[model samples]
Structure formats: C-alpha cells, structure tokens
Target: MGSILIKDTTREERERIVRESLGDGFDVTCGYDDAGIDYQQYIDGKKELRELNAEADCGFVVAHPEEQQKGCNNI
Candidate 1:
C-alpha cells in the first residue's frame, strides 16, 4: 500500500490533485471527509463515498488499515 498527504486546498481541488497524481493506471481511493457537511449525511460517509466513487468511476477504494485497527488486534 502507498499513501499521500494533501494539504491547503479545497475539497474539489484536493480531489483533482489526488486524481492527477494517481494518473491512469492504478485505481484511486479518497479517504477524507467522512461525516463533514460537505461530504455526506451520515457516519462512515468516507466509506460510503469510496464505494460510490469506486462503483461509478471504477477507482480503487482508499482506507487506512492502521487507523482503522488502532484499537483492535486485527492487524
């Protein structure tokens, strides 16, 4: 797995940057803004968005396994 940090930008801009950086080969997944007002209307909104985007755009889903497993022994 690989990761990239994007800062100092609007949500749309960040999305564009991530899309451009990812290029046209591998699938892309965005794991930012889960339940923020601009993202979605529910918790786990990030996952929901990822699924929607992956289905509609054929991009890979983005997720932080370490973060998700921080309090668990599933790693």
Candidate 2:
C-alpha cells in the first residue's frame, strides 16, 4: 500500500470508502479510538488539512525540502 487518494466526497461517502478500502475506519475520521486523545486537536487538524487542500489542493505539499535522499522520498 503506497500513496493513494480518494478525492472529493462527503462524510457518508467517505465512510463507505473506508469500509471498502480498509475493513476498519481508523483513518477515515478525525479521531481514532484511543483513550485520552485530544479529539479537538484532531478535528482541528483535519479541518486545517481540508482548508489547505481546498486552497491549492496541497499540490505544493512536501515532506522533504532537499534531495539528500532523506525520509520517504515518495512525493
């Protein structure tokens, strides 16, 4: 399982995709089933990601700023 995308969908549609893509829904919503998790932060981060994607589709997103062969050169 490498990079993937399931673009443009509502929450219900995302749920269906989760059920199909992963038998579990851990990555579908803002929070996973963890005890004492700061759910507000999780939700806020998810919102931020959505806003960023909306702004520019995050085409400029990067994990590495240089080509030193560091981590996850995947994109």
lDDT for each of the candidates? 0.38, 0.40
* Candidate 1 deviant stretches above 4 angstroms: 1-7, 25-27, 30-75
Q: Which digits, one per residue and each the tens of the lDDT, describe model 1 over residues 5-75?
A: 22334455545545564465523343333322222211222433333443343343448755664544221
Q: Write the per-residue lDDT of candidate 2 for residues 1-75, one digit (tens) a residue.
A: 421233444445544544564466355445333332322332333433333323333235556668556554333
Model 2, C-alpha of 73: deviation from truth (Å): 5.8
After superposition, candidate 2 runs with Cα above 4 Å error? 1-7, 24-68, 73-75
TM-score of each model, in listed order:
0.26, 0.29
RMSD of 1: 11.3
Candidate 2 least-lDDT 10 residues: 36-45
For residue 9, give model 1's deviation from the true position in Å: 0.4
